[model samples]
Target chain A: MDLFINLAHGFSVALSPMNLLFCLIGALVGTLIGVLPGVGPVATIAMLLPITFGLPPVGALIMLAGIYYGAQYGGSTTSILVNIPGEASSVVTTLDGHQMARQGRAGPALAIAAIGSFIAGCVSTVLVAAVGAPLTKLALLFGPAEYFSLMVLGLVFAVVLAKGSVIKAVAMIMLGLLLSMVGSDIETGQSRMAFDVPELSDGIGFVVVAMGVFGFAEIIRNLENQSEETRSIVTSKVTGLMPTWPDLKASAGAITRGTIIGSILGILPGGGAVIAAFAAYTFEKKVSKDPSRFGRGAIEGVAAPESANNAAAQTSFIPLLTLGIPPNAVMALMVGAMTIHGIVPGPQVMTKQPDLFWGMIASMWLGNLMLVVINLPLVGVWVKLLQVPYRMMFPAILIFCNIGNYSINNAPFDVGMTAVFALVGYWLLKLDFEPAPMLLGFVLGPLMEENLRRAMLIARGDPMTFLYRPISATLLAIAVFLLVLAVLPMIRSKRDVVFVEGET
Target chain B: MSDGIQAPSGRSGGFRIRNQQDFYGGLVLVAVAAFALWASRDLPGMRGFAFGPGTAPRIFASILGALGLIVAVGGLVTDGPPVERVAVRGTALGAVLIAIFILVSNYATPITAGLGLRQYETVLAAIVVLLVTIAIARGADRGPLYVVAGTLVFAGTIRPLGLVLASFISIVVCAAATVEVRWRETILWAAGLTIFCALLFVYALNLPFNFWPRF
Candidate 1:
């Protein structure tokens, strides 16, 4: 098949010694950060971003992609060994994985998670090869109005995903959008609400906002309650790592079901790994005959969610590579990465930079392979890190974060902004308001506004163009259906699952 | 859930301080809105036409301002009982250390070693940090003193002394400071890393570096 040959060519690009080394390094670092409870792919990627400035696009992207999926692998390590989920996507893992740890079956929990992730990752990469081209062609159909409507729907969906009172979520999202306006006014080239600060000329860096609010705020919340504890995960104590034949049989169905679900969901705009993992866990729960075992160390819980999350992660790349749409925060960063290389991701990407495109796709499968080989064996080593006190860890992390952020532009203003945002995030956490929706709003707000205004200007101020356009109309309908069906009921329940581990 | 571990009778001062974040955020949102509202006051024309450049930001800011109020109110007036409060000692100390970092980063950049590149000011900064380890130890502890001595021996060797000597000194000093590095264990790990980094970064990739000492 022509596709096979193209893929082979992609392999040639990715298999280089230099690219291989970067991939290995990325896998190692991503896993290390992932195994650590507090650090995440986003922070790690952001720190590594400046280092990527000089490398050729292929090598840089290969390494960055490794971090994203590798993180999914590393995050599971924490969830299985301790009750902590390093990042949000692994929350479901903690339910079952931690139980396994308590039962002294942490080894099986970890092994199954890693293997499931690998299988899911491989299958999703295949799906990407098959579907990536078509979606790219489909993207060519979008005009400014369509993009505007799509972004609006995306932001709304994000708000809907926040498990809280819809009103408060909406409130936080709106506030987030406002926070985004503090720096430069794009259209008029005038400062918006900067209050004459020189830093206002450039908009607030997304990295600074995310790191300060999410990273530092998390540390503060952790520190305020020092009596909280994590059961030490002694790797030596874990037994039955090689899943029993029965255990393997049980998990195969979940991994298969999860991969299919993840691939499909991942293709949609802004519907990435976290959502897929959650959706798979929900599905696995519904299908299992013994539903009561959903939380207390269910291998299916770890397997299905981890598999789906990895599958989603790989397939999520399909959109960004094929259509230039960001499914989540990390993909948004990838967009920045691509832009730095003067390559815009869209229909033209497949045609113009076929090597970069195919190479990246081919490399993901290879990267996933590298991750398991790199991580599974080192489970023993990472478990040892849990012994380090958070007091010692915190200072190092803070200093590193400070250095990374300040060196970004050598601006004290950004540092101040980071501090302010951290406080804001802490407040949001304290108030039981989820800030996840706000982050979505920050990304989509300007894009949505731009598209909407452009559509208005182009159609000579006709509002009906939104409904009249086929693609825009279709997406809007889905948004409405989601709002009416799933989101409304979730909101109506008024019970929110705790995303933060310890909060008032 | 334990009987003896009474849930906080009410929000603790720490919780209260954190709780005020919603209001502070809301207030800033209000200010943002006021500024936007004032800026857009001059849009003299009717809105039946295409939007002016500033219209969306204005509307967006206003929406945010409105949303902030709801968040602030919900935060201030929640009827449900708050969750149990327990101290997280590790997290607290981390915060304190980080705050110190923020202070140092903001006010001082006392450049300490190796490439006088302002970025390397972290060296001097890290040296100051050893004081915390010392302070925490109380009085007459050898750990703090050994750390300084080891650091001096290590920092002494850098460019003037060559990589092996400098690194050996620094590691021995820092390792000796609080955590005793079994000389054998320290040497093995440190040597492994140096060889790995040199082979992978220096030899294989051939990426240029300031391997020579920065005068």
Candidate 2:
């Protein structure tokens, strides 16, 4: 009863004229960025974060949330039209969606993708509202030991889920943790890694690091890929905007199963839209009567992953909103944005700011609806946008990144730091080390440190208390199990095969 | 399974010997971890019932050092592709541009003070001319040159030229980075973006910034 009343209040807030307008704008911009290759949501959000500084917390959060899910919808457009996955999560869509486009079923593939995503979005928004409260309650029971163990588990999962060498991923996590210690220590206020620079006293800004690594490094990588000059985009004959009844019948089961899989996986630490999409496509192949139909215009291939990614995108917020733990880099950026808005995300957020919490949940549903309406009609516009040369697009992105970094503290030093990190990021990419794990570590490092110190203090430096507590012990055990699973030769081989297939 | 550690074909180039990207990456991480550990050694640790600030960092640093060592060892034993060559020209040009921006932004006042210049604007103008000439002489790509010019100009002139004109100049300069720049399109984009940013950032959001230069 209370949930319904709260949801009603949420609808009132989200439906208000001002909030609705922001939601529409966020969704629109999210779609635009999502359609543009190489400009992922992380860079777009970081670029636009400064604009939200003046918005009321509710309006600001609603807009950011809209952008996230909106990107999921927009990502499919490029995958189907140009055979290019605009976002990582949309990579699986290119396998079948593009094939469908070549076969003149582009309109049906896109329409099904949007519909599946909408269904998943609606379901996952309900899941967020339903599960958010219970999870917050569970989180309130966590002690310092439990929280520290949770972070350890989270870091371990980050390594397990990362692509490429496990050793490199672990090293990146450690490096990120080390980098996070550069500012004044939280406990003693002693400057640790400042090197006598006053700016270092407060630590490197999260926006600077994100923009440098994801935004600037990405630009450099795009430039390095000189072979991408001749792109073949399929914009002609985009007929059949709606799926046939037979297509709908075939995908209904896949969408339902995908929603379930994605909703569950998304709540787990280090499980996000990309993993969920990959997992769903693999699951669809396993369950299909003819698996070979998958990369060759299979509608189930398009529907299942699309639904899974959208559901996962929404459910991935559960950890951040309830536990204040960011499961991925995108969520980590959300944490940064929330902190800037003076709202520390944790269990307390729901209890203290019920309107903000519920309004965001309700707005997710509204945003999904807006995306369906906005995307179907604006497909032509997005296709035209895809025609813009990367050369022209990159400069605008660079300018926004520069202005965005400068706006953070009205300081030139941050821009300098961004340039430095961009170089580091490009180097890391050259070495085949994924920067995503490092980002997760950077975001979680301070919280993990604070909890570790508190836990150690409470246990009188025993360290065994983590093992003694049931929840912490269980979490630690899971981390160990994941590590062991990752190392086993058989499982490692199998996982690599799966990842390689997905990559292709 | 035995060949799992090998670099996937086609990714390696001349820089790496024996496809040792992991080896080099591991070496860098180890160096960083060793430095962090050494630097934090002097900080206070455990005191009475509470853990000191250094305790957490030391713990993390030690773990990181151990991980780095393991990765380095793994990298050495694994058979993989040769390391790829770094984009030296692009990287160097980027570094130089950033260096100039930082140097000018941080030292413009001191440089002007030493030169006994009357106004900061005059010093800024002189620095811009010198940097732009150097950038062009070095055969820097239009992208980096434009970025350097835009950022430095925005930083130096934000206070004097105000938000609108400074941002306009920055955006236009940045738009000119591309090879296929059309003057009409660039100017229109510059004007539109300038007005949109001003309206959104300054007018609607009411950020604490000047609309026009005070001087």
Top model number, DockQ? 2
Model 1 CAPRI quality: incorrect
Question: Candidate 1's residue-wise lDDT over A22-59, tens digit each?
Answer: 78877777777666676666656655564565579888
Q: What is the lDDT of candidate 1?
A: 0.65
- Model 1 chain A, poorest ten-residue lDDT window? A495-504
Query: Residue-wise lDDT of candidate 2 within B15-95, one digit each (tens)?
Result: 334547767777778788889988888888888757887887787788778877776666665656655544344555656
For each candidate in the order shown, give its overall lDDT on alpha carbons. Answer: 0.65, 0.78
- Supply the DockQ value of model 2: 0.37
Candidate 2 — which residues are off by over 4 angstroms?
A490-497, A500-504, B1-16, B88-93, B96-110, B114-161, B164-192, B211-215
**DockQ, model 1, C-alpha based:** 0.15
